[model samples]
Target: MKEFLTDPHQIERESMRIIQGHLQLDWTEQELKIVERCIHTSGDPSLEPVIRIHSQAIEAGLEALKRGALVITDVEMVRAGIAKKQLAQLGSTVECFLSDFQVAAQAAEWGITRSMAALRMNKERLKGAIVAIGNAPTALLEVLELAKDPQTRPALIVGIPVGFVGAKESKDLLWEEHQELPSITILGNRGGSPLAATCVNALIYLAVKREI
Candidate 1:
């Protein structure tokens, strides 16, 4: 039998120590925090190289959180994984419409995935909000389309949908074509809800730290 670390804080500290030992980049403090959390969630330090953050993403995300911006996610898993209490403390909120009946109906009517429909339906709410997409390339693509209109543009885009389909292409388009948007993303089909959630949680933690 293996001896397991039962204390959560101790386990996290140990994990961070190991991750820091593996990190090679000279990332900024804010970038480092988000990268560390994403790596910690995925248990993959090698992912550091492919993780891309726009120059303005951290500051944009932080400022939005500071202003009590709404954090919208593509799916409930991402929303559920976020730090709800901490976000509430910062006067921010997280939401997911993936499972909503209206979203389902809209998806059916539009011949699209629920993720895309959810984003489309909530376009107005996206204004100045943080949009985190962790499960669907279609949703990320839809966001790009919605962003063409200033009224629906989000403050920061966390686009890390995992799949072999359009995931890589969607992210590539976001990183390359939408350089003007404040964003964070993995360059390949190597992301998930946990990674997305941890990224937001890291930002929330940083926001709280700034207040202390």
Candidate 2:
């Protein structure tokens, strides 16, 4: 039998220390926190090179959280993984519209994915909100369309959907063409709900300067 750290806090501290030691980036403290969280969630030190953060993304997310921005996630799993207690403390709210009746109707009507339809149906709600897309590349693509109208743009986009299909391309487009948009993303198809949610929670903690 093998023994390991049993205390959650101790385990987290050890994990962070290990991640920090492995990270080779020159990212700022806040940016490093986001990357640390992603690597921690994925349990992959190799993620150090693939993780990308827009210069202003951390600040944008923090400011929005401080202002009680709405948080919109592409899937229920991402929404469920967010730190609700921290969000409540910040006076922010998190929501996933994928299961909403209107979103479903729009999806069927447009012959699009529910993820895409959810973004279209809630474009208005995206304004200045923090958006997290962890499961569907289509949703990330759809949000990029809505972002063309600057007034409807999200404050920060955590676009890290996991898949072998359009996921890598969607994130690539986000980084290359959407330089004006503040965002954090993985360069490859190596992201998921927990990774996306952890990025949001990292921002929440950074917003309050609370110790993780």
The best candidate by lDDT is: 1
Cα error, candidate 2, residue 155 (Å)? 0.5
lDDT of 1: 0.93
Write one digit per residue (lDDT tens) for candidate 2, span 1-212. 89989999999999999889998879887888888888889889899898999999988998999999999999999999999998999999999988888887779899999999988987899999999999999999999999989788999999999999999999999999999999999989889899999999999988877897
Give all candidates' CA lDDT scores. 0.93, 0.93
TM for every model, in the order presented, reads 0.96, 0.97
Tell me, by TM-score, which candidate is best: 2
Candidate 2's C-alpha lDDT? 0.93
Deviation from truth (RMSD, Å), model 2: 1.1
- Backbone clashes in model 2: 0
lDDT of 1 by residue, 1-212 (tens): 99999998888889888999999998998898988888898989999999999999999999999999999999999999999999999998899988888988889999999999989988999999999999999999999999989999999999999999999999999999999999999999899899999888889999999321
